[model samples]
Target: MTSLNPRLGLFRDQHVVRLAAILALLLIFFAIVKPKNFFGLATWQSMAIQFPEFGLMALGVMLAMVIGGIDLSVVGIANMTAIGSALLMLQIAPVGSDASTGYLALAAAIGLSLVIGALAGALNGILVAKVRIPAILVTLGTFELFTGIAVIVSGGKPTSGLPPQYAEVMASRLFGVIPMPLIIFIIGAVLVGLLMYKSAFGTKLYMLGSNETAAQFSGLKTTSLIIRTYMISGVLASLAGLVMLANYNSAKADYGSTYTLLAVLIVVLGGVNPNGGSGRLSGVILAVVVLQVLSSLLNTFPNISNFYRPLIWGGVLLLVIVVNQWGKNNNLARLFRWKGNAS
Candidate 1:
């Protein structure tokens, strides 16, 4: 274990460096390929607006992965939350309503969405921690459960006709430059960083992930920890749903269906081990940026259909997993050699 620590530390640093390099290279490539399109503020702004939709989901997924679990229900939670919020907004302030009424409706919708997200997340936690169902199975079940509820509530139709102020405020830029979604993403990431790095809860989470048995024996409230972790994930998903609602000016049960896959890809690409107990939020943030850049670069070619995006994403995901696994093996070999030399 002692010998492995230094190797893991070095790998973590190298992973960040690799992601940074990839981002820089993608930027240069895009700039050269479509200087007129890529060099413009509009292009960058569009990227900023789009990435946060899945980027926030990736953050939630990262938290689950860090605790040695996976939350497949993030996209479902997001859709359900958005659908509920949209319905509430329509009820409170239909189109052509007063601005004051619209604002009030917006606040109420946000509050309700968050509360719904929390309850949904709590249900997953209860099933996993209390009932001892595997996290993956529990989340998978809830994904369908939540999606079904969203469909029933929405009647398989998009929830539209939200107050204009909702989009005007949410989609608006600060000082005519920075996007609201980008700002929200930054704030969310920073808060997650603080929670993961600056608090006792973070330490306990890591310890639990590293060795649940040890955590249990040491008197850590493992059940509570798991529940809290999933709750945070749920909140993140709800937040992402709100962002999507603003962007699309509507909500639907099947919106961003591919986002669950993309979120997992981002988390894994960010260096969070699927096996658990190790990863960095910083790496996850960089991974989100890297993916957004790659996605923008792909847009440079009109011939590449958006339908192929899943194929591309899946290929990259497999490649990253293989590379990460190979690196681990190589590091273990070196550690063994060092032990042999010392003996």
Candidate 2:
């Protein structure tokens, strides 16, 4: 019994650990419920392909949320970048271009799209930081603004007909099975992890979110940090846009509209404190996998419609919030004389 307690303690020590156990149980449950479907390679492949798009967006959301902010503009920024990239590629290589020319156009389009994303993010940063507006309000307005710009640019239609190269390379797997977007997401995760774990900026971000007043009094440049943080979110959203554009071969002003709320749900489920100043990139990544797998597993059942997924996501978010609220102070821990007593 004592040995079992120590092993159980390992699972209870961290939110990620607990979530991982839940994920493991969920996989096992799905496997038991539908042994044939759950074990199929196609199901796993589809889940892997879908994970990165939402995962990347959720990471952006996590960053903003960590600093006690929310970015409603991520969807808009993603669509706008996608629209811009498609339009640029069309002008550069057109539909009938040779493969080499198409690849060149693709390269140029990627660079231009990233720049557009950065500029858009910079606009978001300026509005939130220098303009002295709340992050929520600023991003909310930019959300519509960017989305509108995408629509106007695309004439309220999908931007398509990119160089053939774009589709070919995007579809091509790294080792003939792993999707390119998954690789991109891995690279992105490494970069984001370094940004958060190895820099003074990350420290300042946490401090600012923990207590802006104290950060200001400590001579930290709070406004600049806020701007930088939003910029990262904007850029990440743009990367997500690229992924969508590549996958669909078309960019629509309203593409992945579901992602906005879904990203929030992922961040919340990843154990990011909505109030701010605490979150783990690793947790968000794990959350992405769990949610994606759950989605795929649920998808195996014909009775569950796509419409209900959002409802389930919202319910999970509410449940987590309620659980956290109930146990946050952990009065019961003190009553039971737990080892780690609250200071």
Candidate 3:
């Protein structure tokens, strides 16, 4: 009889295995609690609608985390972009009866938002990488600064008067049943997945995260990579903001305030190391879906009390972190160690 390879017996990476287990458990929980709602097209559609915007933000957070940095400024970028897009769209639309002008204005708004996002991200990169500042402190400061700017610009008012065509495009189905935002989410996930997993830059990022000094000695342009990562994060967050603005048919200065923590939660919960160096975009995508499902299930319980949502979210986040650490450090490793000693 051939001897089995111990590594082959289990998934090569225990984190991946744990993530799969969590996914399975979530499915089972939903199946038991809300059998009909768990697998319905409507439920899926609802989740699809809500996930894309946050999913985009989470993708950015994943990239930053993979690079051993954090982008707390993302929520700020998102809010700024959202309000900027709304304001630009309003300005560009013709006053009386020019549909073509409205379309032109919408295009301008999107382009402007993308540019602003890139600039904002670049600024963050410069601060953290070139200025030699700690990412957490820099981003926290900018988080407040950017949000304050957004508030000043919006004056605490909800944006409205978007073109009808814009609203329709945002709300309309791509094919027959698929929501456009959901499709955007899928595309973003795939692209980010490829960028993070299959590209040279991705390798550099992982290397940098694993050891910055070693990466620098190895000839990696660490500073440039850091800048690029934040830029990408900023652009993604802005794109998500646009999707959100369209979906809600409004924009506010605080549109993405609650998302900073949520993004961190998703990235860590998706099996990305909070300390950086190892993570998968696919895992993040699955985590987003799982979270959306959990949120939907909670929503179905009318008397469950809305105030508990954050508490539950926090609890789940804490559980994921503890379980992830235990899986990596204690349970799985100890099992392998015991098997090795016995052998």
User: For model 3, how does the per-residue alpha-carbon lDDT over 1-343 read when each residue is reduced to its tens digit?
Assistant: 0011111333545555666787789889989989899878888888888888888999998998888899888888888898988888887774463777777777888898889999899999999999999899988988888788888999988888787667677677877789988887788787886786568888888888888999999999999999999999999988898888888888887775567777888888877787777776656877787778777878889998877877777887888887776676468788788999999
- RMSD, each candidate, Å? 4.3, 5.7, 5.2
Model 1 spans with C-alpha error above 4 angstroms: 1-12, 331-343
Better model by lDDT, 1 or 3? 1
Best by TM-score: 1
**Better-scoring candidate (lDDT), 2 or 3:** 2
What's each prediction's TM-score?
A: 0.93, 0.91, 0.89
Candidate 3 has which clashing residue pairs, if any? none
Candidate 2 versus the native: TM-score?
A: 0.91
Of models 1 and 2, which has the larger lDDT?
Answer: 1
What is the TM-score (0 to 1) of candidate 3? 0.89
| Clashes (candidate 1) | 0
Worst 10 residues of 1 by lDDT: 1-10
Whole-structure CA lDDT of model 2: 0.82
